[model samples]
Target: MRDYVQTAEEAARRAGHVLRAWSSKFTVREKSRSNLVTEADEAAQAAIHDFIHGRYPHHGFCGEEGLSVAGNDSTYRWVIDPLDGTTNYVHGFPYYSVSIGLECRGEMIVGAIFDPIHDEMFLAVRGEGATLNRRPLRCSAINQLDQALVIASLPVNTDRHDEAVRRFLSVLPVAQAVQRTGSAALNLANIAAGRVDGFWSTSLKPWDMAAGILLVEEAGGRISKIDGSAFQLEVPNLLASNGLALHEQLVAALV
Candidate 1:
């Protein structure tokens, strides 16, 4: 493994440890009417920050707990979500995870996501394909829209409910099923592992989707802005799919 990837894996695992430790013993605070954050999130971010900064002193970081430093002269940047699925975690749902990604020169290069509850780790490096616990992963081969299981995320705390509902309805006729998993990190991880056919969500932070995007691509899936444009951290909209043809059709229908 590349040094950065190795370091990321270590950081992710350590963050997972922090997450597990605080899983049920933490207090939740409302960040918004529909959003929550827990002590686990902050603790996990602190551990990741410590681990990564110890090895790569100058690398930039943008973490979910609001950890950011001065941009580095180097091209590398770390995007982290110390705890994803916070609401789920607080409610005793076991779907939360720690996501970490390294982007170099505007391209996502390494990604790792650890689901501490399940002890599952998904990892990918640019051009190296994706894996879960060292086993290679491939996206599903399903091509027909009606045979696909899709995930759609609606912005709960925003006024996008009607628009989100309209979009979901438009795609519902063509999809076999649709779900809202509440965790972009897990959504992308499942896409990479072929457990789900595709995922679409608006209103995400860079830390939430960065790692999972690289994982999906490396697992032979396609990812893009909802309008089919290339995705970037600033413009956080994303649509990841196993079947390109179906993805295009869905995008066309929504637009």
Candidate 2:
């Protein structure tokens, strides 16, 4: 497990290098309305895939940049978001990251998220405590919503009538503070590191939450769907919090 975690970290760092090398030099392309992609994203994923696939040739690969390969006789699959905050990266906001998570038999077993700008590396293995920059990580102790600082993820082009917006408004006056950060991966990592109390999003892809989900759990936080159902990677919605009474409180507020 530690070996896999090491590999994940190496791959994430390698991708981070690629992203930094391409900063401000890559061409941007819109994936959809208000959704952006750039050459840096593709370059970073390619770097990650090449390094990981070269080391573990039989492992399956799924990346945010439309790269997919299934292992023929292996249970290991790496889900990657080489660039999690593309708009931030494109705009030189410096909040983006490279995320890599390993799944075995449909369960997340290893996770790594690396922030190039800050050089912060978050890593976790199943049943093993999580770490940030090699230091142990644990969620914040705030259990009450009224005392918590939280974040939300609203899909690009979200409007006033959207359920996401409605949920955002509902939580704004309840929590100590509510913020909308473009990067879901970092939001989850912050929850794990106890930098934030909780976070939820109804719109995410598997790669977006894969690594960060494990980090939250390993760091002694709680994770589930917004409705408090079991978490599914295939499902887009998620609620992650420092598990005291905060999980239940967030569930009620989000749903």
Candidate 3:
């Protein structure tokens, strides 16, 4: 697990450097109606793929940039989002990051998320706790939904947009405040670091929340589907919060 963590951190950092270098000059294309992808995303994923595959040739890889490498080992897989928040990155928002999560036998074992612009690295290993820049991290202790700061993201080009909007409306009057940061990965990292009290999102890909989910879990947070089901990597909608009294409140409001 330590080796996996180290390798993931290194890969995330190297990919961060690539993203930072291309931040000033990169071409963007629409991946969907409003979602964007840039040249930096592809390049960074390539760098990460090369680095990780070089280190562990027998491990599989699933990257956002369509870089999938199937190796001899079927039990270990690296999930990569070389440049999460591509929209923010293209617009120079500085809120994007490089996210990597390693799963062994279908269980997330290690995770790393690097915010290049701020040089913040959030990492975790299952059962070993989480960290931000080598400092221990824990979720906020806020136990009331009315006083909790929360974040959420709406699905792109989905018929459920109306339902999502209603859910946000449901949370708005009760929570201290609500925001959409354009990066689910960063939002989860923030929740893990105690910077945000809660986060919920729908229509997310595996790469978007894989690393951040582990960060939250190891930081003493709770995660589940919007309907209160167990969260699986393949499930798109999720609600994560500090594992305090407010979790049930959040689920109640969102559901």
Candidate 4:
């Protein structure tokens, strides 16, 4: 799967380049009241799709910028988020990334995430292993929720009455700490690298969680629905942890 890994990395890097080029001059628009999309997002997605589709002309494509292409093999597809943290990029927060994952028959077989600002590349192949910048990756061994640094994803413009906010509040006192990052992809990548102990989200799309799911699994983490049920990509209610004591505790807390 060297070619798969190489192509994913190259595509992600290409998108990252496009993001950087447009960073200084991009115009922003809202996808919703507080949800932002920018010219940079579209341009980076174009760059990513062009590079990947040129290599595998028949591979289906799904991207965050409303790009959808069906190749001859419907079972083989590339899921992409050209700019995983658009708000972060817009504000120069430097926490965004380009995420790409290859799925076969609804199962992710390869995944790659690239942080252009930091020049970090994370990759994983099913049953093989996960890596960060060519070095092996493993989840942190924190076994207890009280000692974990956990993160959650709440939708933009979320308020106190939102279910997501309720979930966040429930975990606030139980886990060591609870934080929110604008980028879910980066959060997952950090989990794989043993930098973050856990992450849970009830609001994320396929592109946001697709690649990172494989990365976490390969890095020795466990993933499931917030209530510890089987996770389905179509309806994302995910809770991912280091597969130690935090998993069950998180499930109980989230429920």
Candidate 5:
């Protein structure tokens, strides 16, 4: 366990360094209509995979770059996103990160997110709470919606967008401010560090939110479906908040 976290963090930090070096020389390509992938993302992911494979040769790997083993053999799997904000990185935006999380038997036990630009590391181990660069972090105290700063991972175009937009519009009048940070890992990290009061999104992959979700919970926040139900891997829609008095109301509005 100790070794896993160490290797993952080391790999993430190394990826961060690579990111900083490549930020100035990035070559971008479109993976889909509005989605993108970059050479930097590939390089960072390769570094992480190589580091983990060198140590744990048989462990399974699943990552954003599509380098994954089909079957789970060692009861542990690494979920990774070498560059969580490729769009921002291509545009020279500074808010990107390397996110790595460990899942044992389908349960997330450890997570680490590194932002090379800022040198901030968010780490979480199940049952051990969470931290940013080794300093313990926690959620905010803003209990009411009117005083809270909320965030969302906006979906571009889907049937769900209308419903999500409605929820966002409803909450906009109540929240002090709303911002989209582009990275789910950092969004959750911000919640854990009390930089934001709450976050919700309708669509995300397992690698995107797995580690960050644990960090939020360990930091004293409450997370559930936009409808106030418990979280599940299959249900990407979520509402995570600093444990507060108006949680139920917020969930009701979104869910």
Candidate 6:
């Protein structure tokens, strides 16, 4: 497990470097109305795939940039989002990151998220707890919904855009504040680090939440579907919180 975590961290950092180098010069194309993908996203995923496949030839890989390797061993797969915040990166918003998660036999065993602009690496191994830059991390203890700071994402191109807006309206007045950070991976990492109290999103891919979800769970946070059901990687909607009393209220508000 430790080896897996180390490999993921290395891959994330290498991809982060690729992202930083191309941030200023990469060409962009629209994947959809408000969905953007840059040359850096592909390049960074290539760098990550090369590094991981070189080390673990038998392990499978699934990347957001369309790099998929069905290796000999199907039980160990790496889920990667080379650039989690392409729009933010393209606009110099500085909140983008490289997210990598290793799932072994249907369970996430190791995860790493690297924020190159801030030089922060968030890592976690199942049952071993989570950390930021090698220091232990814990979720915030804020138990009151009115005192909790929350974050969310509502991609304009998603089919659930209107539903997300309605959910946002429901949360706005009850929580301390609601923010849209454009990066679900970073939002989940923030929840793990206790930088924010909670996060929910109506649409997300496995690459967007795989790594960050492990970080939150290892850090003693809570994650579920919007209706408070168990969270599955394939499920697009999710709610993550600090495992405080406010979680129930937040879930109720989203209903």
- Superposed model 1: Cα runs more than 4 Å off: 158-161
Q: After superposition, how far is residue 33 of candidate 4 from its true place, in Å?
A: 1.1
Predictions in order: lDDT: 0.87, 0.93, 0.91, 0.93, 0.85, 0.91
lDDT of 5: 0.85
Error of 5 at 219 (Å): 0.8
Write the residue-wise lDDT of candidate 6 on 1-255 in tens digits.
777888899999999998888877999899887789998999999999999899999999988977788899999999999999888998999888899999998899999999999999999999999999999999999999899999978866656448888899899999999999888888999999999999998689999999999999999999999888999998798999998778898999999
Candidate 3 whole-model C-alpha lDDT, 0 to 1 = 0.91
For candidate 1, the per-residue lDDT at 43 reads: 90
Poorly placed runs, candidate 6 (over 4 Å): 158-161
Candidate 2 local lDDT, 1-255, one digit each (tens): 877998999999999999999996899889998799998999899999999888899999889989889977469899999999999898999799999999999999999999999999999999988999999999999989999999999988988899999999999999999998789999999999999999999899999999999999999999989888899999998999998898898889888
TM-score for candidate 6, please give it.
0.97
Clashes of each: 0, 0, 0, 0, 2, 0
Give TM per candidate: 0.96, 0.98, 0.97, 0.98, 0.95, 0.97
User: Candidate 3 regions off by >4 Å?
Assistant: 158-161
| Candidate 4 per-residue lDDT over residues 212-232, each given as its tens digit | 999999999998999998999
136-233: candidate 1 lDDT, tens digit per residue: 99999878778899998888664645777787888888799988888999999999999999888777888889999889999999988888887777
Better of 2 and 3 by TM-score: 2
**For model 4, the run of ten residues with the poorest summed lDDT:** 233-242
Error of 5 at 22 (Å): 1.2
Stretches of candidate 5 off by over 4 Å are 158-161
* lDDT score at residue 44, model 2, on the 0-100 scale: 92
